[model samples]
Target: MRIDRRQLLTTLSVTAAFGGLIPVIGQAAGSRDPRLIVIVLRGALDGLTAVPPIGDPDYASLRGDLAVDKAAALPLNDLFGLHPSLVNLARQYHAGQATILHACASPYRDRSHFDGQDVLESGYSVPGHTESGWLNRFLETLPAEQKVGSKGLGIGSTTPLIMRGPADVLGWAPSTLRAADPDLAPRLMDLYTKSDPALASLLDEAIKTGKIASGQTPITAMGGAGDPKTMVAMAEGTARLLTAADGPRVAALAFEGWDTHAREAQRLTQLLTGFDNALGAFETTLGPVWNQTAILVVTEFGRTAAVNGTQGTDHGTATMAFLTGGAVKGGRVIADWPGLKAAQLYQGRDLTPTTDLRAVAKGLMAELYDTSSSALARRVFPDSAGVAPMRGLIV
Candidate 1:
């Protein structure tokens, strides 16, 4: 399907209007204390591969060929082990700067990326109805003055659905090596507004800020040129912008290419290495502000608990959500302990979800923004009053 930028903006405008009703919560007035960054890992992430359970008695048996041995995996704790390629993240975990939420997922149980992302970002109980993201709703809830013009920023070629909300939003991608003619921006904006008012507004804002709407080669560029290494480069660039003095307080980014249908080991290793480098970049660039920043890395869902015929995993349930930053209460794996035994698996195929991903997100919002749990559940994530915000996720 073709991606329509204007249609997306119009939807966001409508959502923004309704989001204003959400009650303000979190962060006291005049507190520029914390920054929040969310990285969306599109396509299902194989949590079993990232954070292997080397100590689980049945893990090796269940995973069989996909199982990673303790000798090869990077040890995170006595019970959990990380992929060897994720050495940077493992170091952070040891330094008390990272934590993993294993067997966590959105309330949705389906396999569609669109629906899963909708539930994850919209904060609504159901999919498609949530026009705005929980983050935008949180921004709307803030007292009027604290709501800056651009409270949200999106990185990459096209903005992810999560950051598309009514709040003032800014988008930035690295400048293309070949610059466009100076007049091209204004001309494009004029054409867009005349043809589509909603798209016009978005393009106008982007143009006014001297940001390009397109042209930069995304890390996903093919031919191996836009592989994991390029992805890390993009992350570093995004981190630099987020940490800037006048930059946005919150941002969202998405990285694709995690769908490992075959040759899982080689592909997963390279991807994890890229992920590790990206985390290192954020830690380095954020510098002092890194202490106050919290980064939540999540995916739409998890892969199957058991390997498929192709030696790959299928769309399943209960993936891992990674939390890192100076503010995180780190060095621990948070889970309610759903064992990997055959009968313990959800639907007899995937790991059963013990923690709602939203709870972790709610906790981050509450801690970083000082928002109240009540508001987070009721307003940010509608009809989510029962899913209390997790505690001690951030220091």
Candidate 2:
């Protein structure tokens, strides 16, 4: 029995690392045709370490071996410094293209990664809304004229909950696998068109997506999810897709392996370095579009302020959110600056969050999409009416 080559290729694409990243095109709504990308760093990132408060009187002693020395870190301001591994971010910060929201968190308070991520993605006051994500919900609220050809881009084999919803979304992922025979796609597409029109449409879409996914830097060269290089490769591919003249305005990507239960320092060095490089790739790849782009990097929760016995920090509350891209009003670390003193910590353990992350997301949507406060409150992030959208985040 001969197997259909098209089916086999589809199977292979799904099995590959760059399986679900899908790019969608949209018509310009008005003069502002802005772009937004949300990168969810799974495995809660350690905020205190990522952006250390070196000037705080109690930071060094509390962190001990886990502490980032002042000399090693890239100074963000007199009070806080970025992890030394983040060279690209440091460069961007100085160029006024990067902004850090320190001591920020979603409404979720528990430390469980699953629950934390659900709240972070679901845009709910609590967890368990797996049917859709806030970004998808926001897409639903767009005016019909603006959404005519618009679709959300979900980057991964399984679409992250944050991009899953009633709105149409395209999925793709980055892979090192060789492309299928060029002739095979056209022939199979013809066969499907003649007999099964539905299947043909699906194949046509897949072919276009596969073509976009093929030429980007292979994921293998960058290492796995744990390797920082992977982040750069992913960002490069994402940039390529978004820069396409008819490409998507909104994209969602998720990077894993940030849990860091042990060996936090060594691991973070590689991860942050890759993360920093990826940001540079976006700036370079997007060109003038960078001026209209806002990249939001966030995590589930944070880690404890004090280092644990395992040379790492345990899950806690309040980490940080990163907003970078030329579209952002950047170069500042926005924090209410909750001190690192034991008494200052939340429940005597983690950084006490002063800013709700929802406000940050809401703010960007409000400005970029011209989404109203009432709509954002009633629809995009239901039950979040009390949490006003943050302003002055975008240029």
Residue pairs with backbone atoms closer than 3 Å in model 1 (clashes)? 16-166, 25-371, 26-369, 26-370, 26-371, 26-372, 27-369, 27-370, 27-371
Q: Write the per-residue lDDT of candidate 2 for residues 1-395, one digit (tens) a residue.
A: 12364444445443333222344445345887788999999999999999999899899999999999999989989999999988888888898888999999999999999999999999888989888999999988888767645678777656788998888776666654554454766787789899978776666666566455545323443355545666766677677677776667888988899998899999898788778888898899888999999999999999999888889889999999999999898999999988988888999999999999999999999888888999999988999989999999988
TM-score of each prediction: 0.83, 0.92
Prediction 2 global C-alpha lDDT:
0.82
TM-score of 1: 0.83
Candidate 1, residues 1-395: lDDT per residue as tens digits? 12466545433321221111111122335655577888888877899999998888989988889999889998877778999998888888999999988989999898887788888877787798656888777777776565544457666555667787787566555443344555655686678778877676665544433321121322223222125765666566566556555556777888887877777888888888888888898888778988888899999889888888888888888989899989899999997769999899999889899999888998887766678877887778889888988989988
Error of 2 at 164 (Å): 0.4
